[model samples]
Target chain A: MQDTVLIVGAGPAGLSAAAQVAGVGYKAVLVEKEDVLGGAPILSGYARLVPSGEWARDAIGRMVKRVEDDGNVTIHKGARVTQLNGEAGRFTAKLSNGKSVKAGAVVLATGFTHFDSVNKPEWGFGTFPDVVTTTQVEQMVTAGKIACPSDGRTPERVAILLCVGSRDRQIGREWCSKVCCTVSANLAMEIKELSPKTQVFIYYMDIRTFGLYEDRFYWKSQEEFRTKFVKARIAEVTAAPDGRLLLKGEDTLVKRPIVIPFDLVVHAVGMDPNMDNPEIAKVFGVGLEKHGFIERGEHYTNTCGTTRPGIYSCGAAYGPETIDDSISQGMAAGARAIADLHGLTRKAS
Target chain B: MAIHEKSLIEPERLLRHDNLVVDGVDVSGHWNTMITPRTITDYDDDFEAVIQRYPGAENVHRCWQCGSCTNSCTMYAQNVQFNPRYWIYAVRTGLKDEIIKDKDIIWQCVSCNKCTSICPKDVRPEGVMKALAHWLEDEGHMPKSPSRIFDEEFTEQIYARGRIEDSLVLLNFLKKTGQPLVPQWLRVFGVRLMQYLPVGLGMRFARNFFIPPRTRSWGRTGEVLRQYVREQKEATHG
Candidate 1:
């Protein structure tokens, strides 16, 4: 049996997992669906990493270089796993490119899909030109300008609506998209820095910047950047006759209903289960939780181990997670795979 | 059904038996409290459009009912029934009966613009409140509210002359609204004012009240504005 680990997806989790596997002298096959590596944050154009304020490309590029330089790691970009067969220590993954890799264990690091803001028609995501998702705003940040999509003028006032597709029963997403609060806070600071004249208002049900990120991003967003946090979930977005977007929601803290016009509206969308989650779970012979994320054996002890013995899952494949958690989980999954493969090798000998 | 606001549910719909025995069990007071099942078939559909035709309420149809307007409303703090969000919802949903129930208090909006400033949807709920008040008056749902009478009295002076004499407007508004000209508070305030007033300042105030100051070249400007207002009122009401 080949002492190799097959890593599905080439996101932060998959790349870190592959790096861990290769570091342990085991061959690691990293299969990515996209033509390029990095994943959503890279493809969608994130300007900078949150809290650190480091350029996204540079931070992610360092990881990409580590994986590429390792001779034990093999990267197959623009490829997807078409088929999975066999059990632990004899797993084979057939690639879309007609290539197959037999490995001792597999790690599914497939990440999440950005929640589609269009699903919530009240946000006026697609209907209004100035109303855009957080991902789209990230692209604008990368473009080095925050301008109204309709008029191409610099937005004098921008409203960032947090938890757009998360924590709302109406959309069937009750779980909080963990990273959005920090991301929105970071983005608010970024936008403020980009255009100091522009007023940034964040309408949020809660500011959930858990851990040190709270002090680094959320606190800084308020204390340093002067970002206005309105404690309310926006009810609707409508375009004004003058091309500005109007937001309706209550300031729950002040207990007042408010309507304010903004030059641009940014919907801080959350993460949904990966679109290929069902298909991936089916092929891998794994189980999915109620939310469609791959079910882990036990979070505390067997954090990376999936319902299927040899098949493991990490990062957003399990649930909504931050990049740091994904990377750490990737390492944990890699360590588990290596240990499993070592046991098999010892038995064979 | 998805947008079931508890505030929108009328007290009449709430059924509660103070003392009751049901099927060998006592279901009294809170235990017996139930909401009557209701099927609303009286949607005016065109109510939102009609309200939108008012001067400030052009964007009434855009209410997503986040409850921000009601939450931030100045009038809402004093009276929970003065809910801009619920009224906006009623207008958008064409619940004419629901809106009519709150007609008396709808004109008490204070023009604080607090709702307009904080609304994320830019529904301009303050304007919607004004439009609703106007609609209630235009439709003859009730007599002109005291606030509307005060507005007309204040506005008519401006439309006729270049500006308004504060005393004239105040007295006229009081007369039109059928309030005592010399209220207890106003009498006390006037007495306090006289105690602090200098002879020159008091004489100037008296002269302004008697003569009523007018802006120069006001005749043509006033005529044009009067005609414009007349046309606008006709266009909106007709």
Candidate 2:
């Protein structure tokens, strides 16, 4: 039998895993829930990367095309793995489309969900006409239009609420949506470029400009885009009669109750594991972390494969992660799966 | 794939700055900033009492001021000095006055819950924040702020209506906070319209709100919570 690797969730992680497996002369079966797959980054559209600053559509399009044309790769659209069984070097996955595939290894690259802003009703996500999530803003940006969702008119003052559902303990979401700080900063700059007339205000606690992009992006956004970074948590978002949004927050540095009015409000919503992960974990006989992310062993041993041997997982399926990190992990998982298959073959001898 | 090379600090390095007294180490005039001669108070008694009250608050001591908690905090993205990690460190070591000095920020948390989720150890950061809030109030360092007033109003409103009444809560919150109404009549009217809907419709509008809703033993829930609190206290104390 030909050794095959099954990659689930065709986001950056899954695609990367498929590409890596193909490079190593192994067949990679890539499955995705949506017809198109770039995960949240693709969905949010503003992949306006610095350096070249290509929109997500173009960047992801090139990546997907590369993986699709690979002879060793099989792309399955509108397909989700409903079941995962067996151990490392030999496993089987049952898909929602009723196709059962036996594989030597499985890689789970399931990504994250946008934390529901409605939970923090004070931020006025569902209630306020102007309040929207980062995902919605991505759609607007992708359309080459930057207008208030509440009213189609161009917004003069815009407030972006950071850490909506992430980093909150009230509703039991305690993990930092790792990407929010960077994404918010990037989006704030993008919005400014899109609408020079719009004054952008970021209501934040501490601006995390970590890694290579940390303070570099922060300083650039501040000096270039003039994004007003505030040190205060917004208490609530209330709407006025004219449909403008009211943001109530404490300007902690100044120790004053600052009430700012804005024409548009974008919630820098954090990431959470997709809801179906728990069921998926049970089916695969794999353990998940408290946050419902796949549990990995030691950083090296648990690079991609789960505690259950023959079952490897990667990407956001573990938790909130970035596109680049997911791709790296996907490659790691592919290498691990191939090694396991090699080990299985050696053991038979 | 071009992998970004990240330097992983050793796990022990995570606790580098934790629990060390600055003996004769004057941070004064370093980095062009004058370090004030400060008296760091050891409110060990108060800290013990706080740990006694909220027994689970011991995790506050486990913090190493690594900025990880603050970095992970939703509020940290908003307020830099409202650093939960630093505040928890101050609280753990009985730096009561320093903690009280930052009391205004105690209410800034929306409890989006990212910090606790990302905490490598199960440190309940929100719980620690609440404990600090309680301690600040108990110590009488600051007067009743909007959040406290809001809490009182919420309790009274919920007690009276058997559920939270949004219109009343807002009105009472505003009335107590002494903030001028931006559009007083319109807000009231709009809320009234919201409330005028049938109970079913109202519940759908504000799921937690109820006017004539059925009441199930608030007394029982309170007692259960109290008992749970007591058990936690005893466990921690033991």
Q: Report the number of the highest-TM-score candidate.
A: 1
Please, what are the lDDT tens digits per residue for candidate 2 over residues B172-232? 7887788765668878988999888577865565755544454675657877888999999
Backbone clash tally (model 2) = 30
List, residue by residue over A1-349, the lDDT tens digit for candidate 2. 2389998888778888889999999999998988886766675565565324577778777778978899988888898888776766667788889998888888888777778888888788898778888888877777877887655899887788888888888988888877777777787888888898787777887666568666556656654665666667988888666677777767664354656668899999888887778877877787888887888856665567577777788788888877778888889988988888888888988
| DockQ (Cα-based) for each candidate | 0.01, 0.01
The Cα local distance difference test for each model comes to 0.84, 0.74
TM match of model 1 to true structure: 0.61
Candidate 1 lDDT over A213-314, as tens digits, reads 977887677656756666677778876776677787775643555667788999898999998988998888899998888888886777699988888888
TM-score of each: 0.61, 0.59
The candidate that wins on lDDT is: 1
lDDT string for model 1 (B1-238, tens) is 2324546777778777899999989987767777775544223546767888998887665554568888888888999989888787677656787788888899899999989998876779989888887788889998886887888988899899979999999898888887897788989999999888798987899999989999986878988999999999999999
| Predicted candidate 2, C-alpha RMSD | 33.6
